[model samples]
Target: MGMGRRPAEADTDPFSGGIFNLNESFSDRIGDYLLGSPNLSLPVADETFSLHPFPVAAPLSTTNQETRASNGHEAAEGYDMGISEQVSATCSCSSQIVVTFEMVEISLHLVTAPKGSPGRPSQAAAMNIEEFLRDHKRALVSCEMLLGCETCSCRGEYVMLVISICRKLLHSVGVMHREGLSEVQNRDSSRERGGLWKLDDEDQAGVLEVLLKIRATRLRRLVTILDHVVTSHDWPAHRSMTQDLVRRLAEA
Candidate 1:
């Protein structure tokens, strides 16, 4: 191909003016807006995170200090109260446990209490007998005193005397069936039983006369009980004693 006189010139930047325009530097217009210097005019950054001069926190005001102190004191007081409540709860639990254990002990003791031995008289029964013996002896003594009074005209006293003597005779015979005669004899060594005379030979007639006037039924009942003691098992020491006492009363 035949060569032309010249080829077309290379494309050039209009802003650069020409391809050899090396005297002007390549200035970035966008970089000026994106990465500006510190002195650039713009809105201020928040002081909280700003580290240019190392952020200095603002000092607390007087009101803020007082509020913080009050909050700390309240927290300490609450802690102390919590400790006291915990201790009280612990003490209450301990006391309840102790009381429960004591009650259980008492219940067990009651359930397992020992029984009294057989054949032996209970303490309460023995006390009752002792009281009865003393009272019976006293009644006999009072009847004997009334029989000695020749001037005493109270019909009630003569009736009580008759009843007392009959009761003693019957009791003397009855006691042998309950226990050995030896036990009664040993217990009543100092106290006279059926042997205690209600009336002397002279007084017997008067006592019998007074009893007859009161009621024939009462006198017959007494004679019947006395006959029973005197005739039955005539060899027993109590029976012999009752027989002697009955003989005196019947003689008049």
Candidate 2:
């Protein structure tokens, strides 16, 4: 080698190669852009990951404070997401390649302050929320296969999106003609009544403790699901669904 020789300059980023920031849009984030999503068939969970949401035997409790916080919710902060059912996964040694399955929640909890801001959960809202959460949890889940990085993340985003939409439906349609404290109890007669429902804690604290631990496999499932949505152009159909969810959650 010659002395004082300089190294050659590369034209692309090491992590992303030349693909970084080439496309910019919600759709791009999910599919055809850097994610390389199929750009088709992402609505149904079945076309991406192999696992789909399944019904829970019993409804998980949402009366606890810590749990609410982990879901990025606060009473003053408005809407929140709770883990009504966290999905779990396993690995298949049978293939001799260490394939994995993801564990995530098939169900969620959406609590609404019926009487407006600072309103305590009324009998009805509480009752209704509980029932609604359980019913939605019971809805079946399914999935397909996928293979990509950004596409995987897009899949996760879509999964988050669908769940968000479902929660919004609960608030607007789940409890109608209900407001304030009365709303809470009537819907969830089983909830421990007459206690303060605290709503000011960061997510990932003690909030997620009740559910089983999340793993990469489960996250993989999420990515796969979102990728399907992005590639297949399901966002158009999911537009209102996700928008409503964002609106309601933002209110809370």
Candidate 3:
């Protein structure tokens, strides 16, 4: 009879279920699974467990060597590893980024005195100029309403209103003259080059021309009315006031 084959050894690896040794106690198998047997290589087994730190890791020098070898760089053999470590340390310490911003305001048409020493306008003077402009505009509107009113039959009241508005307008003009803004001395200078006030000379001239035409038309109307009142004997009390209004309008 042929020799019987030697019995196969039992599988001792805890990873494999102990099927060869069915008589083994459950507690014994569980203890071996938790503590591991001497036959098992702990380093190799540790690889299967991810929660624990690595049993063996590559050294920094070795990793750098492998990187240099793989990259085929111009670094010479046995290059100092401290250089890379120093660079990494520096970058880690001061890696933050910062930015800065600033805001400024500028004006092109800032007003200044025409006759005085070249200097910026004072706050009070600027406010006064603005007030004058506002008052002039208001007076012009008031005079316009008074002149256009047809319901008011009293010509004396009309003359008084017109005279009051004209006085306010003249006062504003006086203030402007005192502020060195009414008639700038360099008004006849080259249009290409001028101070801040003269920068928009052409536009101002156009506006002034239109206003002058309106004034001439209004004066013609006044003369016609005055002529009619003079020739007619009715409303004799209104003659003097009408003449005074006419004179004020002409002066304005």
The Cα local distance difference test for each model comes to: 0.31, 0.29, 0.34
Better candidate by lDDT, 2 or 3: 3
TM-score list, all predictions: 0.22, 0.23, 0.29
What lDDT tens digits, residue by residue, belong to model 1 across residues 21-137?
Answer: 221111111111112222322222221211111122232222212112355533211123223334343323222222323333333232223324342235333322223322323
Question: In terms of lDDT, which candidate is stronger, 1 or 3?
Answer: 3
Alpha-carbon lDDT of model 3 = 0.34
Please report the TM-score between candidate 1 and the true structure: 0.22
How close is each model in CA RMSD to the real structure?
62.6, 21.9, 49.8
Please rank every candidate by TM-score, starting with the best: 3, 2, 1
Q: What lDDT is obtained when candidate 1 is compared to the true structure?
A: 0.31
The residue-by-residue lDDT of candidate 3 on 1-252, one tens digit each, is: 132322333335322233423221222222222221334321221122222111222222222332244576422332344354553343211111000000000011123333332443544334333333323333343344334433221233343445444433443343444343433332544534322223344444333333323333333354445435333534444556556656755565
- Model 2 earns a TM-score of 0.23
- Among these predicted structures, which one has the highest lDDT? 3
